[model samples]
Structure formats: structure tokens, C-alpha cells
Target: MNPTATLVLNNGKSIVIELLPEAAPNTVNSFIFAALNGVYNQHAIERIVSGNWIDMSYSAFHNEKAKYLIPYESQLHPEIEPLPSIAGCVCMGGYDELGLSGCEFFFTLRDCPEHRGVYPVFGRVIEGIDELYRLEKVKTKPITDFPYKNVEINEPIQPEIIRKVEVDLKGFKYDRPIKLPSQVLPKCWAMEYR
Candidate 1:
């Protein structure tokens, strides 16, 4: 089993990630499910913090809330020690207080000591890191919400899309998560917008 997944972006770039199942099994499984189901296709790069990290919340995937909430894998799983968010390292995005992590994931653009021991690191980019930096440096424009009278921040002027995600199971077959949420986003998240 190659245990590698290639993330194809719209910008004519492809990144190969080496999945770390030993470090975070459930997290890896969840990602595999998403990949196989084409949940990550045509997903926009939602947020990017300059010289820091690039956050990806797939439009379709983010629209529905995650059914299963993986535990704090980094803290709970001793085998998976917390590692600094160095360039190309993939990590899960979640709320610790809620004791849940969802589909939103990001890759570090630079060394991020702040995220150490906080986010669950699942994989590392084995190739095409330059593509990661290209996505990170994308020019962004502030979104003005006239009705709400507030500005939405961090939106890219030219949206960078994750065209598709391909996972090589290496003949390893696994079922999807049992509990699939009706909406991948929680009710609380909707309430925040309201």
C-alpha cells in the first residue's frame, strides 16, 4: 500500500500527501472517506493567513456538518505526539471545547509553533510544496456585506479551488463512517451567521 493521496488543484498543480494512519487513524479514515466520495472536489480555499497557513473548507463538504467527531487525537493518542505545524504538514481544524474536529483542514505555509499540540497533525506533503506556497500567496480581496454592514475577511480575489482529491488505498478497503451528519456544519455555526 502506497498510503499516499494526491491533491489536485485547479491551478495546474498537484500535491502528494503521505497519510499517517499510525499517528491518527480515525482522522485518516475520515479523510479517506471524503476523498473517495468526491466531497473535496471543486472546494475553494476559504481562508489563508499570510506566511502562516492555508485553510480549506470545501464548499459542499462544509455545507454539511460532520457526523462523527474525532477525539483530540494529538492529546489523547500518545503514539501521535504533537508536532510543530511546519510547511506542508496537514492538520485538522476543530474546536477543542466542543471536543470535536470536522472536515476543515489546513497545510502550514511556514513553521507555526503556535499550533503545536493544538491541531491534530495527520499527514505531510511528500511532493509539490511549491504549489502549496502558490496557493498561500494568492491575492485576496475584502468582502463587503452591505446588508450586515460588516466586512468579510480572508476571501481570495481569484478563488483557488481544490479540483479533486485522489487517495491510493494500496488495496486497503475501509467503509465510510457510520454516522453521517445531515448537514456537515453544526447548528451553532449557522446561528453565528444569524
Candidate 2:
């Protein structure tokens, strides 16, 4: 399928993300379901690691919450061979063998090919990447400090709220229905009499 795109925080400033269904179908489907169900509304970017990515708490604020874990459907398609977790790429959170993380996701700010096999890459920032870059460059100080062991921490940091997630179907243009390339019938199939 031609990947879908979504614009969030529509009040003036917004962030646009292009969902890659072919690369990460499960992750894209989950994100779409969450958006349609109002899961992203009021959700905060809870965690931000400088030069790493921004992680948002999706299930925490949602009414139903993400109760079940979708299997890790990473870069399986040959078309998306060796997907790279580059800057602006949205990826799924990792979990233990139990499979628990529901709402957490990260957006890469640099090419981290090391994470290709470890993380499921689902989407990319087609627009508003400048805003994301700004957020990543923000100066963050630890909220707490412990002298002896040198333990530092921070919390309650507000990045940016996703006011709403809306899919712009008008932006996508797929020439054909999503199917395996092998399943595509030849053009001559329509001229049976020939």
C-alpha cells in the first residue's frame, strides 16, 4: 500500500508522520487503531534521550490502554530489506519475553542501523522534522542528583502534546491494491480474447 500520513497537534504547529505499512504492518496498524480510538489525544512525549529519540506514553493516557502486545513484525518484507532506523524514523518499543510495552514509541534522530534488527521501524517524519530536531536539541537537566553514587534523574518533563491524530488519505496514491508483487496479475490478463 502507498504509506499513509498523519498530522498531529493541528493547532498551528503540527508534526507529520508517514506510516510505512509495507515495512511494519503490525506497528502501523496498531498506531492507526490508537489514533482512530483517540489514544494519542493528550498523550505526552514522556521521555527524550538527547541524540537518541523521543518516546511517548500512548497506553498510559488512553482509556482502554494497550492491553495486549502485538508480535514484533520488524523488517520482514524484501522490499524493505535491511531497514535503517535513521533520523525521523518511528520505531516500536522493546519488551522482555513477556511482551508488555503498550504505548511507548521512539523517533530516531540519526541513522542507527545497529537497531535495525532490534527495533521495529514503522514510520517516518515526512514533514515537521525541523520541529522534531528542535525538541531533540532541548537542554534537559536531571531532576534529582545523588552525590555518593552519582545518580541523576528527571521527570514530569513536557515535550509536546499530540493534540489529535488525523490520517490524510488524500495524500496517499497507491497504483494498485496492497499485495505481494508475485500476486499482481499481468496487464494482458484483462484482454482474455487476445
Which candidate has the highest TM-score of all? 1
How far out, in Å, is residue 111 in model 1? 1.8
lDDT of 1 by residue, 120-165 (tens): 6779999998888777677986544322233234668887888989
Which segments of candidate 1 are over 4 A away from where they belong? 58-60, 65-68, 74-76, 143-153, 175-194
All candidates: CA RMSD (Å): 4.2, 14.1
What lDDT does the true structure give each of the candidates? 0.69, 0.59
Runs in model 2 with CA error above 4 Å?
1-3, 74-82, 100-102, 139-159, 169-194
- TM-score versus the correct structure, for each prediction: 0.79, 0.70
Give candidate 1's whole-model lDDT. Answer: 0.69
Candidate 2 C-alpha lDDT tens digits along 40-152: 77665555667777766423343444434554553234455536899889887655343323345678878888878567787888788887776776566554322224322
Backbone clash count, each prediction separately: 6, 0
Q: Best candidate, lDDT-wise? A: 1
